[model samples]
Structure formats: C-alpha cells, structure tokens
Target chain A: MSKKINLTLKVWRQPDNRTSGRFEVYPAQDIDTDMSFLEMLDVVNDELEKEGKDPIAFDHDCREGICGMCGCVINGQAHGPDAATTVCQLHMRRFQDGMTLVIEPWRAKAFPIIKDLAVDRSAFDRVISAGGYISVRTGAAPDAHAVPVPKDSADQAMDAAACIGCGACVAACPNASAMLFVSAKVSQLALLPQGQPERDQRVVSMVSQMDSEGFGNCSNHYECEASCPKEISIKNIARMNRELTRAGVRS
Target chain B: MASSNRTLLQSSIVRKQIVAVTGLAMVGFLIAHLSGNFLIFAGPEAFNGYSKKLHDLGPILWVLRIGLIAALLGHVVLAIKLTGENHAARGGRYAVSNSRGDGGFCKKTMIYTGILILVFVALHLYDFTYRDKTGDPTIVEGVNGGLSLGLFGLVWNSFLQPWHSGLYILAMIILGFHLSHGIQSLFQSIGFFHDRYTPMVKKIGFALAILLAVGFISIPIYVNVVRTPHL
Candidate 1:
C-alpha cells in the first residue's frame, strides 16, 4: 500500500490582530496518511521553514484532546470533520489525497484574531473568572466522601464535570454565547454539598461575566451540544436558569 | 464560571422541559392574537372593536404584555447564558470536527430562524404599536368614531400589502423552524424523556409547531393570494 499522498492545504495567516490576514495555500506531498492532522500541519510548517517562510501559527496544549485548545474550522465545520473529539486528535486519514482544505480561526465577535490562526481566547478566562470557581477555603485533607451527595446527583454533577473548559460551545453557537460552559461550571458545583455557600451568588456572577465578555446570547439552538466534544446536554442551561431565577439576584 | 457539577445542568430533561413550556406558552399567545386579528376579515369595524376591547381592560393587557416580555427575556437570557458556559467549558474549539446543526437545508438551523424571528418581532411591533414613528402606517379603516383604520382594517390592510404579506409569510416559516426545535428541546431540557412519553411528546411538538406556523401563515397568504385578486 502507498504510505504517502499529496494534499492541498489553505491556512489563514496573520502577523497579529492589528494586521490583516489571508489564506495561503501550501502543497503537502508524500505525507504519512496515519499521521494526525496536526502532525501533517507540522510537516507543512517544516517545509515552509526550509524555504525561510514563517510557519503558520495555531494554538495547542495537550494535543491529547483533554486540554481543549486545538481547534480550527476545516472546510467551514468547527473542529474539522470529527464528532466528539478535539482537533488535535483528528487524523489525516479522514481526508482523501489531493483534498483542498481551508482552515481559519474561530469566527465570532467576541473571539478576536491574535495572530495567524491563533485567536484571543482570554475572553473565556474572563468568563471563568466571573464565577466559575467555588469560594471554599483550603483546609486539611478531608475524606473523599465527606460530602455525601445523593448518588444520582453526584453522577449528574460528574457529567457536568466532564466539561473540559473547551470553547467549542462558543464556536458552535451563532451568537458565540458561552452559556453551556458557565452552566456546567455552575451545575457541577451546585449539585454537591460543597457548592452550597456560593449557590446564591454563582448564577449572578457567572451570567454577568458572560454578558460583559461581549459574547452573543444563546437562542436555544442545540448546535452547541451536537458539536460539543463532551456531548454536554443542554439541560445544564435550564438548571442554571432555575437556580438564577430561584436565587433571584440581590439587586 | 460555576463548578462543573451542576446536577440539574446535566439533565437533558430539564432543557427539554424549559424549551417546551416556554415555547408552548409563546405559541399559545400567537394563536390567540391571530384569532382576534382574524376578526378584521369582517372589515374595519370588527378589527377596531377588537382593539378597543383589548384596550378597555388596560391593566389586564399590560399584565399580559409584561408576562410575555418576561417570558421572552427569560427564554433568551437562559439560552445566552448556557451558550456562554458551554463555550467556556469546552474552550470553543473541537479537536475533532463535526457539524451537528449544519445541514443543506434551512430546516436544520433553529438558531438562524430564531434570529430571523427576533428581527421580525421588532418589525412587527414597529408596524403596529410604534407606527406613529413611521407616520401612522396608513390607517386602513378610518371612519366614524375612529381616526385610524380601527384595529380590524389596520390588520386586514397589513395582510393586503404585497411586501407586508411576503414578510409575514417569511417570518412565519422561520418561526416554524424555531418552534419545531424549541418545543421538543424544551421537553428534553426539563428531563421529560420517558421512553413511553418521549416519542409522544415529540410528535405533539412537531404537530403543534407546524400547525401553528402553517395556520398563521395561511391567513396572510390567503389574504394576499386569494382575497386581493378577487377584490
């Protein structure tokens, strides 16, 4: 069997947000079909470097799909063409030889272009800073089961915990809203006994943060979940709403 | 940025419930209003009389509008909040790519339709309530005791216009798309997915959204296509 194939790649290039960006096509030949998509890009980047041209810049952390950093729209789809996986895990086998790929950064009003393919995702950090954490103080070691929440509740909370803090929800959303991420964080803690102290304040702080981030509002489109690598259910949204409504802000 | 363990947040059932309850309520309002407006088919007096009746109980109408506004705000806000959290939780980038909601047809995009409907709502209110800003929107049935078309002729005349009727039909089509996804998803949101009832609820949702959308659209389509030529 042939071990390598030729391909065409269109990558977005920009020096930084202050400058304009455009697509640059690169020819990839004799590339390992078994290589991951990022690896293929590395091969392309290496070739570009040999020619003294600057390589394309994109974001990646773990490359294991756990860190939730690697992402790009391949052919107009968020995260390439795979379901339930991050872009780092995507392999080149999915594409046929000679396929022309168009890659771009996450397009949203809230997510600005930082450079090349890398986008400014600090807005996410701000949203998290708003209210994504528990206010509990550090203490000596406690029993793992010290907080005995109901088994079902614990399980559901675990599901919310599955959220890897990926911004795919925002990318998938037309409004670029991050309600799912906020709700998941809110739900995960609120479900357990440890989350009680902050329950009243969680919803308000988190929601306010989301709005301040300039992210668009969700219109109840389930696209976030369908494209969500974690498959996080939209149910978290309702739970957050109920909590916010019940807790009703102080002001 | 709440904790990851919001137990209720994980329940798809809760999401469905919220979507269904809110969507159905809004649909109910649309139907009732449409029925009242249909009286305009009787001519200007009927429409104006209906408007007067609604205005007579000023507080009641105000309450209704307030409730409706609350519902709309709540619905949109929750949706936005969830979308934000989801984005943050997932980091807004997938390692793998799959376009779940992207299809070759408009029927697949509830979000798109929802946005369109939102714009339509703004236009709709402007055409009716704030018509004063646009110079009275051409009073349709002005006559004894009323300087305006009297609510009936105003509504009927709205349907009679080619542009207005076109916009109405287009908006309704998008509204239908939004309803089909929203109603069933609401059931899922609130955790109403029993094997015995999930299918039934879905069918019910499908029927209702399509029916309301078709019926409401038909009124304008009929007024424009069939009634206008005859007159």
Candidate 2:
C-alpha cells in the first residue's frame, strides 16, 4: 500500500537559452510515495498539458540511473539529497507530504541552459573527443589472459570507468570544476595495459581541453565526490595529477 | 620546445603546483621565525644577540629577504588569477545554496584570511622594521663591544600597547586558519595522496597550525600581561 501526498513544487522555467529563468509554483496533488522524482514531474507535466499550459521541460532517458541524462539541483543538492542515486532513481518517499521542492538547472559557464532543466553537456563530449580513446586496432576478440593485467589495476580501472558523465560534479562544485569527471576518464585509461601506448598524449590533450572549456580548477573541496551518483572518489584526481606529471616529464 | 613548455606551465594544474610549492616554502620560513622569536623569553641580552647575528649576515640576509618577497608575490599573483577564473566558471549563483561541508570554514575563506594576513604583515614591518614609533633609545652590548639596536626593548614596548598586542593575536589566529587547510592541500596539489597517510597528513597539518598560532600568540600575552616592563 502506497500513501498519497500533496506537495508544492517550485521549478525553474526558462523558455529558451536567450531568456532568463525564474521559478514558477505548481501544486502536485496526490503524488504517490512510490513514485520516482521524474515520475512525479511527469504527473505534473500531464496536468499542465490538460490545462493547455506548456509542460515543464526536463531531460530524461533510460530512467534507470545509468543514462546520465536526468539531473537537476533539488533543494541545493545535485540529483536530490540521496547519496549514490540519480534523479530518476530518487523516490518521493524521501520527502515530506507538504514539502516545497526547489529545482534548478545545472549552473556552469560551460554548460549553458538549453531549456528548463536541460543544459548543453556537449562540453563533456568535446573533452572526450580530444583524447579519451585508446587507438589500438581491434580485428577480433583477443584472449583475456593475453595482457595479464594485475587484479588490483583491473579493479581500479573499473572503478574509474564507472563515471556516467552526468555533469552533476560540475553543478555541485563551488567553482563548477570538472576535475573529477576528467580525472576519472584519465585514470580509467591510464591504469590499463592497452592505454600505455598513448598515455602521455591522452592526459595532456584531455587536460588542455578541459581547461579551455572554462571549467574551474579543483580546490580539493570534495563536494564532487559527495554529489556523485556513481560514488566516484577524489583519489582519481590525485592519480590524474600524477599522470599529468609523468606526461610532462616524459614529453 | 620552449613555447610548448611555457604552455604547460600556464595550464591550471601546473600553476596550482607553483602556488603549492611557494606556500610550503613560506611555511618553512614561519617555523624558523617562530623558533627565533622564542629567544625573547631568554631576556634582552640573548634576544638582542640573536638579532645582531642576523644583521651581521649583511648581504646574505638581503638575499633571503628578496627570495621571500619573490615567493610571496608568486603565491599571491597566481592565487588571484585562479580565484578569478573560478568565479567566472560558475556562470550564476544558486538561489538556495548549500555546501556539503567538506573542509568547513577554513577551506572556503582562504583568500579572505590571506588578504588580512598580508595587511597585518605590512603594518608589522612598518612598526618594527622601518619606523620606530616607540621612542625607546635602549642599546644592547654586542660582540667586540659593538652596539646594536635594542630590538628586544622595542618589541617589548610595542607589545605593551593593548591595540598592538590585540592586532598581533588576531593576525596569528587568521594565519592558523590559513595553514589548517593549506598544509594538507599543498601535499595533494603536488600529487601526493594515500589512503592511510593522507589522513595522518591532515591531522599533522592541523596540529602544526594550532601549535604555530599558540606559539606566536604567547609572546604578546607574555609581554603585555605576564612580564612587567621593569622585570
């Protein structure tokens, strides 16, 4: 049995990138406790459609916390207040019945608002396109034991590879830094055997791209780790620094 | 090749490394200064003797002074540049902002505390090094019967004023706040991190900060409240 609750929603509404945004209040009556946060928004959007009002625009895909599409700052926390959870996975049971939820888009110079809650995240794509790939040829599936990767290295690489590129780290940082994201990408590839050939070039290119994108430098606040949906560690940042140093020395 | 190296130096992380290195060098200078200042407890003869020795070094002391000034300028200039870029990165402010409370008050207000300390340093140099506001003409006997300025007497007279002691104590407290975060942050900035040792580094940094603050503050308290001018 699920309990029904009424709530007041204060959502940021911007028509386009050219217009400034403002918060608009909407009454969400009889929201189910079992409903996901995005589902609650869907209910509100349906009501707005029936009343001939424009639906609140937000980005979502997969709705299973892996797509890295759904995100918004809820009550001053990115992806709501849950640890290791995305906006699509956040349940309404976490909130009080009459609580007023304040939602806003990701605020960063590199991530401009496209509509209401959807900011352009192509800056991350641009960073990836810079050097985030290994350039080895793949003819067929090779033997798993050919490379003989250490278990510890393999596990650490997997940990770094868990980044979903959600841009929540940027939103949560006081300086809007993307170091955690870029470091994770750099570390994941740097730890593997196949990543050895282009290690120096990859780190240098990705870091330069990240810097040019107007992302702030990391001041070691650890806020990004706290707000991360995948529970990424800041140790990756230290590793990235070491990798940068190694690249500098080798080049 | 030179141009490419220059580009690497201009990168955000490398610039931060420079800031960290220079900041750590200042920390070393502070420890040396505090140790020398502790000689004040040994009475006027010992304190003035120490000051004379420093003055006797002549050109070497000037070199050290110039090096320290260069370090301070590098730390301030690069820090301001990074802070401006950081401000611009956040395109706008949040209506309802909340911190995750990662490093607390000390970590967030580095720039503000640093500026206050800079102001205090300027006034300190003016009062003690350049200008003699206190009209004490006491001269201490030096090696080879040479006479040196009684730095001990001047320090004591300046500290006797409540306003001067109060300002000195306040500046020390601000320096403590700056070092509490700065000590641990410098290690991380220079690519040093560990699961077990990093926590130890933080605790050591905090203990060092508290020690330095209390050590500096004790001098003024001793001069103003404990020791009489005649004694």
Off by over 4 Å in 1: A249-251, B1-26, B34-99, B102-203, B217-231
How many angstroms is residue B164 displaced in model 2 relative to the true structure, after the best TM-score fit?
A: 0.6
Candidate 2 residues lying further than 4 Å off, grouped into runs, are B1-6, B101-103, B132-149, B229-231
- For each prediction in turn, the share of the native Cα contacts (below 8 Å between chains A and B) that it retains comes to 0.14, 0.51
Report the C-alpha lDDT of model 1 over A1-251, residue by residue, as the tens digit: 43787899888887987777777889998888788888888999899999999988888889898887778778867677788878888888888888888887886657788877778888778766867777666989798887678998998899998988767777777557777888888889889888888786776767666666667655566677777788787778767766765664332
> Model 2, B145: alpha-carbon shift in Å?
18
Q: Write the per-residue lDDT of candidate 2 for residues B135-171, one digit (tens) a residue.
A: 4434322322333336776787678779989999999
Q: Which candidate has the top score in DockQ?
A: 2
The candidates' DockQ values read 0.15, 0.49
Model 1 compared with the native: what TM-score? 0.70
Give the docking tier of candidate 1: incorrect
Query: Residues A60-85, candidate 2, lDDT per residue (tens digit)?
Result: 99999999999999999999989999
